[model samples]
Target: MTIWEMLAVFAAGIGAGTINTIVGSGTLITFPVLLATGLPPVTATVSNALGLIPGSVSGAIGYRAELAGQRPRVLRLAVAAAIGGLCGAVLLTVLPPTAFETIVPVLVALALVLVVLQPRITRAVQRRRDRDGRTATPGDRGGPLLFAGLLLASVYGGYFTAAQGIVYLSLMGILLDDTLQRLNAAKNVLAAVVNSVAALFFVFAAHFDWTAVALIAVGSTIGGQLGARIGRRLPPQVLRVLIVVIGSAAILQLLTR
Candidate 1:
């Protein structure tokens, strides 16, 4: 790749890592850059997935404070994410790319809607909990419904890798009783699990552009830390708006390209 192209990928990686940490749509930033840089679709997807692993891990670490009491939650969700990710990776290798194209845009749109309505969803959950005279404890387990939703989201993350964070946030916001920042921290861990599991398969079975991977790894790691710092300070409404806007952009990108 040209130096300029490498620079662009690196820049995208930074933005992606930041966004992934804050909200969950970083792939939307980096994947198109890879495509523009001349990688074929599948190769770009594989390389992008591998490249973002470090950023995801870094983002998770950056949110370690929020993650402190969520070990059981993370562990349970990780299982679903790992299995779903493996299934999605296998599908990516075996099925035609067009197989998922039609559905992805719809998923992005749905995620956007959920993000926009998150405040209402949270309020409703709060009311329901109050009616039941239940107080939210730190050890709240998400149960089977959340597991199913997360598994489906992980499958989507494995296959497409765009806007999966928004999906996770939407599910977690409604299903899990916690602050958005805490749920976001959990989102990063789950996303990392899905990406890491898929990356493991891609590393063995798929071709990649290592330069792209390296550039993104470095850039996204930095971005992840930056995002965690900024994201933790933003008001919930502002963060939700940002997520909706980015999710809309992801939908537009997918529909147009």
Candidate 2:
């Protein structure tokens, strides 16, 4: 990669990691930047999975305070995430570029819709809390459902992780009993698991764009840590809107190209 590309990817990593610490759509930033750097679609996607592991790990650590009570739920969700990651990686290696191309539009559209609607859904959840004294914890009826969502999200993460945070937060909002801060901690961990295991598979089995991957990983690590440190303080709605806009433009560019 050129020095310029390297800087761009790394810078994106930092921004993405920061955003991911609070919200869930960091991949939306890094993946497209990787593509713009002249890497093939599949190579960019695979290397991205590997490169962002550190960022996720850092975010999880930053959220350590919130992670304490969610061990059982995290572990159970991780099992399916690991298996699903492997399956998605295998499919990625075997599928042709045309297949990936066809899927990108669909994935982006799905994420867009989910991102658009989640606020309304969460607001409904909040209204429930205001009206009734009852509260839902992560381990309640929400656990199984959220776990299932994680597995599916992991599978998609393995395939192409753009708006994955939407799915993660959507599930966390339902399953977790902890404060939003704590549930975010859980999001970082589960996201880390899915990315870590899948990244492992890609590095050993798939040829990578090491230049872009290295830069993005380094930048994302720093960004992820910084974001985690101030996740709650960040203007998350502003960031999410920015993500949606940037990600939407990337999809349009890809389509129009």
Top of the candidates by lDDT: 1
Residue pairs that clash (backbone atoms under 3 angstroms), model 1: none
Per-prediction TM-score: 0.96, 0.80
Expressed as tens digits, the lDDT of each residue in 45-90 for candidate 1 is 9999999999999999999999998999999999999998988898
CA lDDT of each prediction against the hidden true structure: 0.90, 0.74
lDDT string for model 2 (17-135, tens) is: 88777766687788778888888888988888888888889988988877876787778777877877777787788877566556666666666665566667667876788799777
Off by over 4 Å in 2: 98-135, 138-141, 234-257
Clashes of each: 0, 5
The positional error of residue 149 in candidate 2, measured at the CA in angstroms, is 2.2
